[model samples]
Target: MAGITGIGSGIDIDSIVKASVAAERAPKDAQLARLTTKTTTQITSLGSFKSALSEFQTAADGLNDASLFGTRKASSSDATRLTASAEKTALTGTYRVEVEQLASASKIASGSLTGDSNLAFASGGKLTIGLGADSFDVDVAAGATLKEVRDAINTQLNEKGISANIISDPANGTSQLVLSSNKTGAGNDLTLAASGADLQGLVTNRPAALSEAQNAKFKIDGLSLESATNAVSGAIEGVTFTLVKAEEGVSTTLTVGENTTAVKDSLKKFVDAYNKLITTTNSLTSFTKVGESGEPLTGALLGDSTVRNVLNGLRSELSNTAAGQGGDPFRALADLGITTQKDGKLAIDDTKLTAALEDNFDAVGSFITGDNGLMNRLSDRVDGYVKSGGVLEQRISGLQKTDADIKEQKADLETRVAAIQARLYSQYNAMDSLIGQLTRTSDSLGSALSNLPGVVRERS
Candidate 1:
């Protein structure tokens, strides 16, 4: 309508309306843009801070374990024969082991058969599978083929760890149904019994043991020990040996010792992670220096008390001395050569730390992983911030809500501005119509005056 509004009035109504609308929109647009930028920056900064906290927590977790300081390194002279692993409780010593036999699962093959094409198993007949003193019966449905009966047993009694399979023995030019036990032990022998003639001939009186169930026979330091499985435990305190195969005459030496390198590596990771968090917090909370022609730039979280509190809390926890250690032997991170730098970052003296760990390994473990240790305290603090309803989480949630509010405000502004534009157009159209009517009225009066002969009428 504004496009045709200025035609009668000889004034550009469209331009006037556009200018008015733009003036009305400028302030709100600028305000919304500023708010959006601030909210987005806060979200990104909080995300970085949270990620740094999580990473530092992970590093702290690595050192939180007492066993990390007492980690045992296990090695087998011949890995092909056997492999070993040791835990923190493992003693540092050398052990000679010889594996005589590997524990085997019990397997039985039925007498030679032409094929598993069909079987005349009697209806409602039952097959009993025995493992040690435990046994379960599988019902043989009427007119079940050998394959169908195998499937029924597998589907029904599979919970008992019994598996049935039809294996083709080309070497013997015959096919046989095989049943095996899932467990490995001499006591876990597989025995089968069938009540029906069809099943009895096929499963009962299992032809000469295909492979007898045997226990893993091995000797540790010349002391004979038997295990139900290849993985033998309790032979050595906190150490488990896995027997690969029998090496009758060969003996493998297994040595267990403290893994000092691993401990030092974990400590260094903790230090590095702590320093990273310090750097991130500094950036988030600190301000940039004034430029040559502008004022100083504030950080995303500048003037935020939460940021300051978090940093201060972490520093306090890190600097505190752990309790439960009677003496100052290794009670603080400083004693382990992890000192606080002037910039609030942790700096590790590798040589001093290594010497400290080597000299008092157990005391160091007790100090860092004790009930009131640095890691435990710090972990608890960080958990509060990142866990449900924590300070940081709540802050982020509030910021998001503010963002949502801003979005709604912008939408409302757009609606109001559109309505204003429509009103301006309507006003201009009414003004144009009034001006056109006035012009026509003046022309009619001039014509009437000219027709009275007092005024001359010009020729067209």
Candidate 2:
């Protein structure tokens, strides 16, 4: 057999064809990828929605309410409402009045002291003493012991007010409890002349009853608002702005925001995305390549007029006029410098667009933000495509599976072809070697005939 071997067999035309077919199904590989389109739309819608909410929030954060969380501290100036008993309700407003009795106005201490020169009990520990008509007990220290006995006497001592306190006694090493009352108002005025240890300078002076003031003040969006009492409500509709702290000035600078650059950038993005979608869609339309063999997308979606109609509608849809509460706010995308062309695509004029935002921000907001906005619509379409049975998701999945299958089959076919090539080369080498041996054998036979030439020459 010849030593020569086969090279590639024939060109693997089947491999090429199979590869092409698999590639043709490549779009199906993107089915799942397409499903995420809805998520993108969802994110867009959520952003727009949040933007809308921020607008209202800005208008609702100005008023202040004091009574709800804070309390006006009580002072000595609180108005006095005389009570016949301790169950008396608190008085309203501030005042300066002398109290006849702390616990009751009806029950007044009567009679005068006899044995002891002063009205103070023994020292300031625990004293069991007898009063006008009833025996009483008193304990005096500094503050609590001072008010505790007074409270007990005011509520129980003939229902009259009783006040007492212990004075620091340097002589006895123990504090003395001083007890006194203005049982005879304007006359007794309550006197405390401690006996061997009387409250000489302590019980002589006293403070008059007082009341505190209660009122609230606040503003909304820089407008002065008032509350009848400390508790305020209905200052602003839809949202109540509480004035936590009273503002001294009227013209408060509300530093909202002036970042039109980002908004302008968003406009450009919308335009760019719109055009890209249109261009992609157009490639599938009657727009054909000059010498291409086939149209990549030549069916209802690609070449169909109906498809163009839908696309043309999108120009209107994206730039659709939106009405605002203030009138023609979202009248047209051009209003926001988002202009539509005859080619059914949109473009943004960055400078003019940003200027428009400064002049009238509500219009731009109405288009992409409010009820039935472009973001919401686009998101809905995207959402539909991303779910389990969506078109893009299914198409991408199909393409991917198809590409995978083709790749697998191509690998298998290459292996089998390599095996076949090895076998064919083996057979071709055998035939080439047999041809070489036959040629050598014929040459040896011719040489033997040449040696018998001398006998023929003698006969001649």
Candidate 3:
């Protein structure tokens, strides 16, 4: 309700009512606003911290695999003639490779027919095509054209490594049906059999093979080898040779060696990622003086025990030695040229690292990614903070709950402040009405006395 303003009592009742309500509400509003700001800041800070920790965990996990150290690179002296690839199981060695003859696929063609490619057959029957252990049948309809037979065979037998096409000879007015195999190996020849007289002409009196099926002949270290396909594997352990062309007399070298470059790159990546994570944590927990005689500004995660604990855990793991060592030289990260700096970040010595990888590569793998190794321990520690229901997650959950409660309190404060304002308006309006009534009563008495011949009205 609107209160009377300076009426009858000559006082600003609305202003007085406003002042009273404000005085009643000022403290509570300030308290809730401060709580809201503080809670929101904490939530944002924790979120950033969690993101940094998760990123660091990913870096650690990348280096935690033993296979990364066992990776091998295979190379051939003559890349155009032959190329090779190696797996982790490949042994490091040098071998001479000689590709003798490349494998070939088989193709067959029927005797020439005395008509155009569109000539219709007298009758049709079941035509079965076979390649290796796979075969498919095509039912040729009576009076079917040569083009129709080729289309039907292709539609059903393309995936089975068999394809059919019509080779037309326009000069002689004759056409021949040709069948080919996609497989390149011995005993994988294309075969055609028919059951009807019209289809028998395609199989019974066909010419010799257009190209004979043959196996790949190659030699590794002067040991003769044969493969059904051009891609030869298992001749050399963990090495696959893709024979490009036949180089019968020419010899090439295939060298299998440790992929030390990959390992070095991964290590460098881990170092960079670790440093980036350290920078993030430092920023989140920093404090600085703003100006002369001004208040100092603190970071959102300053003095956070969770951050302290996480850093401490990782640092402790980095400083620990790997397990089960009997005077092994490369037993820790320090031995592999990784060291801690004054600012608590990792530093890599390139020369020392390369030497260590060259000298004892397997030992380097054992120290960094073996059982109870530094990366494994560090990754485990990070898991405690970023995993579901972990420490950081629980902390964030609690802060969210507190924020929700603060919101409820803010809502309640608004309700109470409104009730106070309404009551003050009602009370002040009633007081103004009473004052007006009292002034009217006094004026009536004074007029009666002045008219009774003894009292006179005075003017000031």
Candidate 4:
């Protein structure tokens, strides 16, 4: 096939074979190309739709929580003195908080030592450190330096809430072993006991208290409260306030109120996500002019009933009243100023929406997050189409099978084309051989006639 195919026949046999094969392959190849393009387009369209649907569902689900509606905002009059945060259970009120004392951790330092001093402990020595009820023991080997003792205590007893460090004074050029408790509060102090002479000198016997362990003392609404740490919670229900600094008689006022801004922002996000989904679905199901030739181009999902059903279902759910809006005036999304536009997207009336949320927040929330609420209904419907083994997945799976079938057909057609080419080459070669034989016969007869003796005598 690679060499000169028509050399023996003096004919363009290669061109003939190519022409025959092309004629047979043209229709089948075109069909496969069209099918391939269609399947790929469908897959891409479905994937885009599913992605947009997923985002929309997530936004809707955020608003589906009841606690979000009851969100509370906490503010401190003097944040420098205190900082506060409130949960959904926190009631709206003002409280006077006075910080009596900020908690301090227990810190102890050992006697000074020379810089190059290499001190060793007695053999089989053990250092036992305790913090409240928790205790841990560190094994001390003979000839262990101050650094070694610090490292062993840190690496071995870290889980027991103890830290060890060797602090060096630059002016004196002396280092001492300092031990501190990881926790704060009265009774949560570090108590060290050692069996070796060196270990006892470092932790047990010769120790100076750098800072005393103390509890956080503060007053909440004229009621005194004490905590192990500055971060005090449960002193007031659903509220946690951190005591930054204590100024006697300087009280900070903390106010807890409804967080309407968060609710409004959440609603806006849901609207934006829903609009995006609508836009995506519209484009995928629309028709438009394709190119300069002015041919009409249909969308990949045009005339798809699955797309139509999903859109219709969502629209219906959005228009209906929520389940738990028994006597509330705002039962449907439309009541809260969310209405359907002519282009199938949702538009919000800011004035009405704001008034609805500000005037009757609880009622509005009930309408949207109730059992049969718009978000609940929409969430369920979208899940049916986008979830695994759902409508969109099934459609994509079918298109993939079509792709496989197209490949098989293409391979079979190629085999047929090759066989046809072989047949054409054989026929042309036989015809060329017959023509050569006839030409040879004619030359031989003409030579014999010219050599005849009678013809030569006549010419003289």
Best by TM-score: 3
Candidate 2 per-residue lDDT, tens place, 1-460, comes to 1232322333343444446544644564454345444434333433332233232222111101111111122222222221111101222223222221122111222222222223343344433433334345544433333335445445554344445444444554433344554242222233222222322222324222111122344444444444433223343221222223332442222112333444555555555655655555554443445456764433223444434444454455555554334555555667666687888667677777767776765455545553365555544434434345654445545645655665676566557656655555455545545655666677777667656756444354
Tens digits of lDDT, candidate 3, 324-392: 388677656788899999998899999999999888988778777855777888889889889999988
In model 3, where do residues sit more than 4 Å from their true spots? 1-16, 70-73, 76-80, 111-119, 128-137, 166-176, 193-195, 200-208, 248-252, 259-262, 321-326, 341-343, 439-460
**Clash totals in order:** 0, 34, 0, 0
Q: Summarize candidate 4's per-residue lDDT along 1-460 as a digit string, tens digits.
A: 5355665558888888788889989999999999999999999999999999999999999988888888898899998999999999998889999999999888877767656334455454877777877778888888777788899988987776788988887787767777888799988877677786656565534556778889999998888889999999998889998999998788999988777778888889999999999899889988997787888988899998988888888887887664443677875788888898888788889899888877888877777785766678889989988888988899899989999999999999989988888888778877777877777888899888988877663456
TM-score of decoy 4: 0.82
User: What C-alpha lDDT values do all the predictions have?
Assistant: 0.82, 0.41, 0.85, 0.83
TM-score of each: 0.70, 0.35, 0.83, 0.82
Q: In model 2, which regions exceed 4 Å deviation?
A: 1-272, 275-313, 319-337, 347-367, 386-389, 451-460
Lowest lDDT 10-mer window, candidate 4? 115-124
Candidate 1 Cα deviation (angstroms), residue 250: 2.8
| lDDT (C-alpha) at residue 210 in model 1 | 75
Best by lDDT: 3
RMSD to the true structure for each prediction, in A, is 5.5, 18.5, 3.7, 4.0
Residue 352's lDDT in candidate 1:
87
Q: Quote the lDDT for 290 in model 3.
A: 83
User: What global local distance difference test value does model 3 have?
Assistant: 0.85
